[model samples]
Target chain A: MRFINVIKVALRALRRSAMRSILTALGIIIGVAAVIAMVSIGNGAKSQVEASIASLGQNIISVYPGSATTGGMHGGWGSASSLTVDEALTIRREISGIVAVSPEMRDRQQVLANGLNWNSSVNGEDVTYLDIRLWTIAEGEMFTEGDVNSAAKVCVIGQTVVAKLFPDGDPVGRSLRIRNLPFKIVGVLKAKGFNYFGSDQDDVVIIPYTSHLKRIARRPNLNSIIIQAESPDQMTRIQQDVTDFLQQRRNGRDPDFTVRNQQELAEAATATTKTMTVLLGAIAGVSLIVGGIGIMNIMLVSVTERTREIGIRLAVGAHGRDVLTQFLVEAIILSVMGGTLGILLGVGSSQLISRLNGWPVLVSTSAIVGAVAFSAAIGVFFGFYPARKAAQLDPIEALRYE
Target chain B: MSHVVQLEDIHKTYESGEVPVLAVRGVTLTITGGEFVAIMGASGSGKSTLMNLLGCLDRPTRGRYLLGGTDVSNLDRNELADLRNQKLGFIFQGFNLLSRTTALENVELPMLYGRRHFSTREIRERARQSLDIVGLSNRADHFPSQLSGGQQQRVAIARALINEPQILLADEPTGNLDSKTSVEIMGVFQKLNAQGITIVMVTHELDIAHYCKRNLIMRDGRLVSDTPVVDRLVATEQMQRIVTAETDAKLIA
Candidate 1:
């Protein structure tokens, strides 16, 4: 007759068979736990990918040499030639949306500081490279445009080289030898960690492009160019401007180079990770459905076992709605209890995994709420038939049941 | 006298695998308020089926059955349940007290099912008073299994009385008890009947039937005899000896 009374009756019935109640709860527990854990793992991976894409700077654009479409050298190298330093300067002057531009020359060499030498690459660029790649000088001054023009021997080193070569001293204003040529360390770059490909961004060295082309690479051309736009909203216009400018600079030869914007790469990464999360969550949901079916089966058995009890209540005064309400409440209580316990278990296990294995794990609020609601809905959906059967039982036959 | 229950040409037929088995054939009966009656018949003679019809648990295949002057033959399931709660109390042979509940709570169950509103204290107090009427107030906290067969039947009787129903229908109430316990239970029934509560009991025991003022015997789904018990025994006077023994058992427990 009253809602609380229905809960009391359902609880009393569940208490009658302790072992069966616990066994039924076990299925829901595993189901909810799997959902929470798997969802957290998926969210964790997605968040990590987002962080990685963010680290690359959403306003930055990378231009790589595009392959030749027609008769590449008539079978020459089949690849586009390196962009020149003069082309990079022309882009900074002509492009309407360009915020910064840095032409780069890269070569492998052993860096010498004090008595320790590390085999790492030398990246030659102007002061604009730091802004284009979203980097900052942590120590002294970065090599200026004057250094690039005069071919000065000043350089800016990454945090990794500073750690290895100058373990106990300040690396700024110190002399380091690259390719057996002496150079002054003008500044230390800030740490930017690793990328998706596990490449350490802090392990390279930066120098003036003039110095790199004249002394290190001994080449007259540039390798690539990094560009930063005013904002992410301006990326498309900036890409068009760069493509048009490069084609014109190459004498309308359809300059063999490709422009990649950060927004597109981030979107691709997001799509990949979101798909992975759903795939994992769906697999875990199968176990939840099985758990719901298990609850339904046990509820059916309970109705059968307590047939006489149902009869007695019906004989006394209970309506079919009353009988059905009692059983449905019992099912919900069991699942809710299981859901709460499963959340605790899932969260604790995720934390444990992160701490023990150093794996990325983030528990989002949506995952918790989603799992709990799903479990409760499962109880109602699966428990309905058994409750209906109990409600519809014939009181006369039930009273006579042994 | 105002009749508490009436059956007019009632008929019941059971369909078992395409064959109709007649359970009751055109039985007409009336029970007045405060009358104590017994239906005596051999097994399968339709006495229990008639009891079910009176209790509103089942409907007759034909004819009208009236409880408290209201025709209930065509009532819906919920309305029939309401009629049972308000007008009838049932006691079964197996002492159908819910085994897990305490005697007090078991008595309060029927009252709880009805739409009437009562505070918890009021419900408990009413249940306690019903238990006292059955002389089981001291054992209110005891479970069904903790009591003897006769005591459990008394609890059932208490449950039946809790709703203050106009009629008590007991189907073979003492069928599981020994001779002494059966007579003691008969004493309780006589006392209740004397208090102006109408009762209809089904029993095969001739001696048990003698405790009631009126007796009807059925054979082959039809009433063969209706007569008055001219020399009904004073069951309470005979019950004193057994009550004394039961007192000793309660003390031991």
Candidate 2:
């Protein structure tokens, strides 16, 4: 028999029980939808984490002060003043792959501005700090190198600090008094949403490290130093060089710094969401298997119900392979059609959930293609036995069957 | 005249369960082209088994059965199916039309499975022609459930003829029909037979047996008698007489 004719026969048989065919296909529909929805939700969360991590900085390496030893006694990482601002400048001038350097020193204090006072974190940094952190200035401009060299009492305020200290309007070109020292607010930092740790990124006041060291904090040691790598390929080499040079500068003393790169931070941040995605995908896979079994069960029932019909075809000269092909094609058509509809429903529903629940959802083309292909494979896997049974039946016995 | 079917000492045994039951015992038969013959017997007399063997639905245990001058007894499953498609047509007593299918599609079924290819338009045209030959062209679009028993049987006949088989096999074709409908079915067979198509029918009814030109009677898994009918029954005359009697009875009422 011609292949086209076989398809027509299979189609006619399916249409014979249209309601049953659709109901049988519903199992597959739900299975595919669950897979798509769960995977997209997981991807959405992962993307959100990645975006937050990107907000931290691009190609950044951070150096934190390590433990200090005092003759059989030890102080943990941030316990002693271990790093100096002069060393940060020395490293930036020496490293070839280094693009920018920001020596960080954080201290929280009450700041008064425009007849209002708010306690906020004060950070001392370089002019290149905004570029390395991928942050944009919302108003005015950052403090220049001349400001850092002269110890000018100029500062940049973050969005949260602006909202708190200057509620009426822009904080740029204004005055804020830090620890009784009135500093000019030169710029307003753009707002960045919450980080993966659930802490706000836009609640800081930034000043030149020279100003914080000479006028406010009255200290010479620094808290941390942030470095930007010129290219991804050279980040590790630069990080190694900075760590060795800093340790060498100690000259056999207890190491007082730990260096970490951006990739490590991103990996740590995304670990939880990746686990969540795998768990959701596994649960959805179980439903898809159940759907396949449902298809097998319905196909078996159909074969049993159509024994006499099969017998008639056999008697009229249909080959056993023809019968097998017809029934197998029927199952594949059911699953493929169900999978197509499921993709539409899954994409639409995921977008709707994202919109209504205010959650991120990313529907990928590969996921859509994989779901359809998986459903078709399920069809073939589940459809083989019943089709074989129908094909191998004795024609005489089948004809005699009521 | 060329022999359309030649069976030599054919044997069929049913080893289905623990015990073996002999269904056909060394039956020899020959049917020439254009001949109308009927085999009559009681239930369990192996007439159905013989019909199945002749139709290539089952392989005989021993001996050769030649259909259209080709030996088909030892042929494999697919080969036998091909032979059935190329050389034989079958009509069952149950009028086993696929449910929910239109009569036109039922008629097109044989051509769908045949070795020769037919275009969609050609298949449709041929199905229409087959239905037209069976005088069911107007009812082509109607499903089997909507058709009467006689109409459904006619549809089956149309299906059988579509492949233009060398032999037509009928196993109690009129067993499920009332007398008038039976006569109508017989009329169709006789008309086809007159057009030089070979026909073999198995029926328990003696009256239906007489409609054939020759008769063979089986008993105890063996053929007991084979003879030409001296006074054959004509379906057209019987149909006419029935109509005249119905009209006369209505006049009396």
Which one is best on lDDT?
A: 2
Best by TM-score: 2
* Regions more than 4 Å wrong, model 2: A58-77, A90-100, A115-117, A164-171, A179-182, A194-200, A227-269, B237-253
Candidate 1 C-alpha lDDT tens digits along A1-402: 888778767887778667667867777787788888888888888888888787776578777776654543432222456577777888889887778888878778998979999988798887788776667889998888888889999998888998999999598988899989999999998899987679888998889988999999897777678888887788889899888877776786655777777788888899999999999889778877787778667766666556777888899989989888887887788878888888888888878766776668988687778777777776766566655765686678777765
Which parts of model 1 have CA positions greater than 4 angstroms off? A14-22, A49-61, A64-81, A89-100, A110-119, A126-128, A131-136, A141-153, A177-183, A192-200, A227-283, A364-366, A400-402, B237-253
Worst 10 residues of 1 chain A by lDDT: A70-79
lDDT of each: 0.84, 0.87
Per-model TM-score on C-alpha atoms: 0.85, 0.88
Clash pairs, candidate 1, are none
Q: Which pairs of residues have clashing backbones in candidate 2?
A: A66-A256
> What DockQ, between 0 and 1, does each candidate earn?
0.59, 0.70
lDDT computed for candidate 1 = 0.84
Interface RMSD of 1: 1.3
